[model samples]
Target: MDRSQVEIEEQGLGANPYGLLLKALTLIPSWHYFLAFLILSLVFLYNFLEFHFLQDLFSGFRGHPVCFTYNPCSVIYDAVVSKCRVLRGRYCATPWLSSPHLQTVFLNFNGRPPVFSYRRQLFYTSDGGTIALDWLMKCDVSGGALHMNSSISRNETTPIMVVVPGLTSDSSSAYLKHLAFNTAKHGWNVVISNHRGLGGVSITSDCFYNAGWTEDVRVVINHLHKEYPKAPLFAVGTSIGANILVKYLGEDGENVPIAGAVAICSPWDLL
Candidate 1:
């Protein structure tokens, strides 16, 4: 072949696009590939150990909570046992979050909570401490006017649920936000009773909330009852807040202002 033909044939053979990639790959050490594979395997194994798919698949459905009251023939048992869907229905947990520990961890780490815009009311306590009450009123209530003096005409009698959050939790907590949003959606007015020194309000006095402190809860309920005298008032307390609420009910006895109360995950005893 002539010089031109030889040059053209050589260039064609040498111009292969994959040749550069093959050369670069050849430079990588063999142990690097093994290390990469080992890291990937470790990650996969850790994730597999963290979430148990087999156990969740079989034990996702749980029984309902037991009903307790003064009498079996009382209206509470009749309504709760027969009509209340939450009491009568099966407690089916999400299969992915079957374990209680796993559920708590997942909720803390990556919970997807509903969005809310609350009308904040800062209440000063007798000891000069501050409590933030985040109210999620009805849809018709104007956003700009949430004060006691505002024109709340027909909705004055609407039921109100005062939610007291767990220790170190506030209205911004995922669980409390979900509870408030869901309760408000059902035509009831919901308010998150942020603990003293919590919910972005600074502590003004020496008074601080502990696990068994019930004075804060008592004052909040009484204030809400006084402000909306016609409105039926209810309270829901979770975790440390539950302890406070139960103690308040016991302390106040029949004089408690709330029409009903619910305490979730209350501790058995406090020292």
Candidate 2:
């Protein structure tokens, strides 16, 4: 048996839970399909979402008729908006996907989209849950000459935006992917901070992450800060993820290292 299996057995993890999870995820086919239509709908589903959604894949829809920054006369209400150039298009580019209701429900169920580009990996938090992370790096660390190994999460210099999804959600959600894609375009490194176990991350401990469990977020934020000290770090969260981000910010107060943060649809009642 491998060392990992031995460790699992020693910890009484019951037949190596992570091994089983890894095996299952390996068989998880492409996200471009509906249930029971996997093999048969490959060609159809591919072209359907691929061709249709790929048009504004990076430039996704805008939220709220309140502020449509893509429109010339639209107001920018958010304080921490980016300096990136606005691509010429409607504020709500794809009304089909961008509608707040559609986006919210789709995000609630972890919907995937076309051109889902990211480097999916795992971040073992101090509290023990293996948080599934999707890294979309724009840093210029090529040739492996930066002395980076497979273990290193990122190299320095390029700014980063860490996105956290809410309960019952993961990085696969359309809304989260949209943000990640747009951030990647403007040369900002994007990393989706999926909650433990929601995004195919292997469960190692008996405990799973909870909304008020800000320790995991604290560790994640500190880790990111340490990994890319030279890079400006910012955070974005939706729903419960947003709640956690807010708590963390409040906990740290003026000492928070984050350059800025934006939390959309934060669940205040839960806290």
Q: What C-alpha RMSD separates each model from the true structure? A: 12.9, 22.0
- lDDT by residue for model 1 (75-115), tens: 87777656657654555557667456788888877888876
| CA displacement after TM-score superposition, residue 39 of candidate 1 (Å) | 20
User: Clashes in each model (backbone N, CA, C under 3 Å)?
Assistant: 0, 0
CA lDDT for candidate 2: 0.69
In model 1, the runs with Cα more than 4 Å from the true position are 1-74, 85-92, 140-155
After superposing candidate 2, which stretches have Cα over 4 Å from the reference? 1-112, 139-155
- Lowest lDDT block of 10, candidate 1: 140-149
Q: How many backbone clashes does candidate 2 have?
A: 0
